[model samples]
Target: MFALLPLRRLLICCLSLLALAGCDRPSAIALDQQVYIWQRQWRAAHAQALVASHADFSTLRVLVAQAHPNEGWIQARIDNDLLRQDGRPLIAVIRLDGQLPRLDSSAIDQHIQTTVRNWQASGLNLRGVEIDHDCANNRLSAYAQLLHTVRAELPAGLTLSITALPAWLSSKALPTVLQEVDSSVLQVHAVSRPEAGLFDAQLALRWANAYGAVSSKPFHLALPAYGVALTENGDVESEAPLPQGGSRRELHAKPEDVAKLLRDMQAAPVPHLTGLIWFRLPLAGDRRAWPLVTLQAVLHQQPLRSNLQVTVQQQGELFELRLVNSGNLSAALPTLIRNDAAHCESGDGVQGYRLQRAANTLEFVRQSPGQLAAGQSRALGWLRCSQLDHGGFRVSP
Candidate 1:
């Protein structure tokens, strides 16, 4: 390179130019700094933070209440004084549904009655007891009986509440239901459904309104601090949300996944989230698949991926099993997967598919088709059994 100007000459030229421009070196530097500040700091300071997506549940108490023969009643009150001391309304959960590990309904009733009495005795007014269930079911009648016995024998200050199912919204399904429960909590967690239609928030509103009018009672909602991710095997992947929904998408969590399910008679709405209860509290923190308890976003594991991809087509007793391998990896069908429309899937991979011999047993496919790729699905199985289930019984044990 040839030298265009010496260092001393260049420096002299700049100084001469600055003098003609009538601006000091520091003034020019200040102007450049102002430009930088406007481009960075000013924009940053003015950027809007996101608003919360979940219903304002600051006054909620997500109680994890449990009872047993000798284990004694576990209350968020005595167990966690911070919650009790704060006077947050309690959403006492009493496990009234599902297979019980020695869950005596009589014992459970006695415990609830005694607990409510004791709370009244202690001058602690409880809002409600969340009776968890897939639906009101025959359980509601039994619960109503238990509640009547309890209310008749208790102090006047206490109240009883239970979870509601959105399916109750249908007039035809509302007959054998509870007539006098105080309030109902609609779980926005997993609707008692196995499909995608039950996550609509609008359906939730109608369901809640219907039940509220039918019972002539105010309905409260229990919003989930998380969402569920299901795999092709029909297993839940993650289950909790974080403290706040992230990003600016505002695709925030809604409280009606239960109502969106037309089957849930008890769906809660955003305006009346009632006493926000986070279903059950995790003994451990969040899983990699789930989120923290109250984060707004759906606690997603990997994008908006679904884990349900089984294809079943039945043709009388002799049916073929065809499964579409929508998952990332290839898997052998241990049993012929059945659905309402089809008995088993056919093709894609069905040379040697398996089938269930007993209620819970998987046997080798009488026929043999081989390895299937991702996105490819097929099943091959036969059922001469007396009766096949509507939800498609698993061919594999």
Candidate 2:
């Protein structure tokens, strides 16, 4: 009996050691999701409310905007109506302006801790905190120090993550920076130059490989579902400053374009890549973002087809040319509408559409680019033609 008891003890110890080793290992390879809520309001009637109900996400990162260098972070308050009783975890995101002065690390830490406490007191599901600073490469070392301090100050069971720019992958301080955080989100979609596209698939692949080869901690790729537009302020000799939110010169990326990029990344994924985190959760009131249905199509690898219909309405002296989209997604407005005719001119919405004379045809071009949504139509301008019916007008991208 004594000999049997010693053998049983030995086997139990061996099993416990194996269990500890398994616990220390990396988590299972499973697909997860994280979403960002950039806006302040989160009412039950918000578009994100529908998204939250439909999406299979693990977390929601809420934006805390800091307007100026010295301004305190403005944290967003979540409406209980928008979240379920047992909702997905929340990550408080602090967005700092690139041009802001260096922040006091101690003060920032206190601010974050206080914010976390407040969220906890509000009966919210707070999980982590993320820094969304586009720090310069030269300032990476300092940024690393700040991250370390912030990580240390975080409460038990809470994590620290940061948004990493592509430039950070090549910095010497990247290793030091990653050492302090639980994970990082690399923003693959960006609009640096006003004329550049929303994202570059090739560039994103290169960054994924480079960062994956060096990064020790798991990272997620951040993508955009929104659009941007750049307009000149005035007819100045030099370039003018970019417009504010109220400006109408916004640009957008087609849902097809974003889908193609996502497919490329999926085809050639990197190691330690956690998952994708969309730049924003679109709201019903947002004019610059694609609809949630379009975003879902992209996620499911569905292609968007353009359905353009041109109709003519006779309004006494002139005919109005209208373009309509009756498909599942949006269609980019053509730069010009051409017809080999003599009597076509600008329509009633001439401020947004212009008249141009081609070599053999009259053309009406859009003064600004716009997106035509499904079941939506826009009047290009008034067409002055003898016949009332639509005849020879063709759209050109």
Candidate 3:
């Protein structure tokens, strides 16, 4: 018995090393482009930059939504193919309805099988499939069974993955649920009540570390890459102005917020960490979101840049001061713009702009520090005078 001790120790050591390798932190992350509305292009150049910044692959969201509780699934079509066929593998993301019934799993599975097969036939190379379901914690068993059904029908050699919730990790059924899928994505960013903010960096770190300690399955961390404009009436809009939604209170994670998340992950990486996937890819119209450079910087663990360019432009009847961020991160503006012979007034529906009178100069002050995101430009306010390049009317440094 004593002679077998060394051999047993060696076996244990080998198993430990294999486990460590499986849990190694991500070297390459992925990007998810959820195409819900019509877009003119895919921004292939930006995607190429993402790949150059250690992005592994792109997952295009092909929504499999249900019109009614009992009705069949309706597959949303991809509009403008922004990504070029550059031989990089793409994953087809199938998102089901949050309130979808467990009884409909059979039909959903069949639809998924047909949908994936059709995607394969479209001449686009596919790397795998990801099913996004926001099922309740108690229903994990049913979800697990559904996953098994879907896996059995998937084409051989194709990978299968799922988007998992933080709450699911603590449930007793998570282990068995994990066994059904090849990989899982832990989503850390989500919409919360307006008062609670959009994301919590500390909470995300704790959850990521906890998952690493429990599960041995390879998983990706999903972070938010998009922003939403939430209004007083609780209406949400993305990128563009919402005419019917009234004034918007922007809810988004700044570049520094995302940077902190990345740093926290590196400090305490999950054991089974495969990679990361941004919640949704940014397009040109997504003015409230982070730019490609910012995303690249976060992935590479580089410091964010601050480049704010100020300019004045005249409209039909009004002259406005425009502030643009040209760097990789957002910045709080210089509070005051002082000029001796000019009167500045906040534009209609604009908050945070006020004017103060000094002995000889008028100080146009931004009462609240508003964040201006990189690559996004906004009109600060209008000047009562139409003269351009007024010497005394310069912004405070």
Candidate 4:
């Protein structure tokens, strides 16, 4: 008994060391949480929100939805909607179902953290952090472990959420919800079906109940407002900017159909609905879809325009650019053509515009699409080039 005392003490010391090592593991939730934090900071510095109340992640510029009244919005226009409130934390999105963007965890962490911090320094308030991505039911264990590691690393007060598929909540995977998530979100828009189709709204509601039952936190459900335009066979028609939402134009959905869908949602009973998230803002609601242009006046400060489209194809013998200039007369005047996607342009037949040549290609130096007379349209001459590998050809005017 006397000899066992030292051995027992040694055993206890070893056990304590083991516990400390376990505690030192990084938290997966925390890692992603930081990513969201950096994104919020970036948004605050980069983008300006229309509604001065709170940062609206639901805006078209979702990626940079961290801007607010105090922080100035970036002069550039890159439309996205990820935050609904002003200067809030970024919702860092990572797709777990598919192959990893890259294998190295360090690489992933560095990239994510750098992005989040850059955003935060920009002036946006880093409040709510979210990761929007898909994960399989069977692989939930690995994902849960990752989340646990991340949660350990993340700072307090930063909200964490994950996007879960309907199949994940199906009978078998439903039970593991408690082990995996802090808060959950159900994406009503289905991305996958191995054989036939996705779970309906009723089925989705049941999954929500099951998920909410298992987890202690309050989870939210996300649904699309303008993203559900379908073809004759229920396939997505076209992913265009919800008329005037962003750069999207030449969409197929009829103007009247916008309000019609809203009416249907209101009539149907969506229960346990903490809040409704329009999956996307600018892409779903544009000036045409609404009455008297309330959304446009409030959201978009200037005239709405369809995204500039440039189609490069072989026409007869000369290289051709099938361009669609979409915007009302209010945006700008169009005078000269410019191509910036490629540093080279084929300005064989135009004057007053600048062009640069490098190695073996001609590039457009500047653009003045706004120079065109408002409401009027014109097509400049094409460059006659038989060049086979013309991969660097684009048109902008």
The TM-scores, one per candidate, come to 0.43, 0.70, 0.72, 0.43
lDDT of 4 by residue, 191-295 (tens): 554123322445455555565555566556654323233333434423332332323222222222323333343444333334334333332223222211222
lDDT of 2 at 156: 97
Best by lDDT: 2
* lDDT by residue (tens digit), candidate 3, 80-178: 243334344566667665776554667777777776777677666666778887878898898889889889988998888888888887699998888
Candidate 4's C-alpha lDDT?
0.42
CA RMSD (A), model 1: 22.4
**Once superposed on the true structure, which residue ranges of model 1 sit more than 4 Å away at CA?**
1-59, 66-78, 99-104, 117-125, 135-139, 171-178, 195-198, 237-397
The CA lDDT of each predicted structure is: 0.43, 0.73, 0.66, 0.42
TM-score comparison, 2 vs 3, better candidate = 3
Model 1 residue 359 lDDT score: 37
lDDT of 1 by residue, 1-397 (tens): 8769988999999999988887542221100000000010112211211012123233333434554335555553343333344444554456543444334556666777766666555555366555554534444455556555644554465466666776656544343345556665655435655455324555555555665566555455544433344455454444333344323211213322422322232222333333334332322232321122222222211222222244545566544444455543334444444333232232222356544333343343435434443334444444443344534434442
Show where candidate 4 strays beyond 4 Å: 1-61, 64-90, 95-104, 171-180, 191-200, 228-273, 283-397
- After aligning candidate 4 to the native by TM-score, how far in Å is the CA of 347 from where it should be? 41
